[model samples]
Target: MSSTLAGAFGIAALFVAVLALVFAVQALRAQSGTAKAVTELAATPEPQQQAQAQAQPEAKPGTVKSELRRLSRELEEARTELRETLQHLAVVRYDAYGEMSGRLSWSMALLDDNGDGVVLTSINSRNDARSYAKEVKAFESDAKLSPEEEEAIDTLRKEASPTLGNPDHQ
Candidate 1:
């Protein structure tokens, strides 16, 4: 009986040892997993995460508001650079007297903000009222106009409507 009791105790100790070893192994694996997660997090860049955060939402419709604000800044820059309206060219064609052959008149207006531009025009029928327009965009008083005319016209924008008034549209 004494020998049998001694054997049972030894078996229990062996079982306990195995259980302890398993527990230790599990603990090591858990620790390693935690360490791996920490290392990966540290490897990431703060600025990249921030940039991605800004970039992802910038594509959304909600960010359209923000985009409009940015557009306003760009539009302001373009307007500031407009010197002479002729630096940009706009043409208007319409019937001068409302009837006669193919057409009546062609008028081209070039202008910047503050409604400063000229109209070079021809009318088939004589009229007292000439073509009129509003200031669409203006150049600063001191800025020199560039000889490249296309860039000047490209900067002129149509006036904004209520629905189209979103700065991004301009």
Candidate 2:
């Protein structure tokens, strides 16, 4: 009877150990899932998080509103200045002379958002090169434009539109 009781106690101890092992595995799995969730949350960017990440100094309530208004004005001024910048550009290369086969001559158009800028052309020959600049206003030039120069301007206009047609169409 003593030996039988000892064997029964041994079986109960084994059962308890198995139960503990199962619970430990479940807890580890739960902890890993929580860790992954935390990592994902940190990786995602929210506006508030970005502001905090920038480490901007805290401002008084009234000052914050005034600062935002000043920033808004500055942003508008930057946008207006950008419109006047010559950001649109295109180039056309062709053989200007019948004897020149390498197509080294080229015409380039540099324009702003308002289609105001200049077209520069370079005519290349074996012995010499000639360069010219024509002022453009509203995509048109007071001076006569060569075919290559006109093509360069047209290319920039087409590129500015989604349909690759007239920019005014949309």
How many collisions per candidate?
Answer: 6, 0
In model 1, the Cα lDDT at residue 138 comes to 38
State TM-scores per candidate: 0.28, 0.58
* Poorest stretch of ten by lDDT in candidate 1: 160-169
Model 2 over residues 38-141: C-alpha lDDT tens digits?
56435656465446535755445554333443554576678677777798889999998898888899999999877789999999998999999999888889
Off by over 4 Å in 1: 47-170
Q: For residues 1-170, what per-residue lDDT tens digits would candidate 1 score against the true structure? A: 99999999999999999999999999898778656745643465746644654665553454434444355446667755543224545555566676554555565546644445544555566535443332333322233322222233333434312312233332
Best by TM-score: 2
Model 1: residue 49 alpha-carbon error in angstroms: 5.1
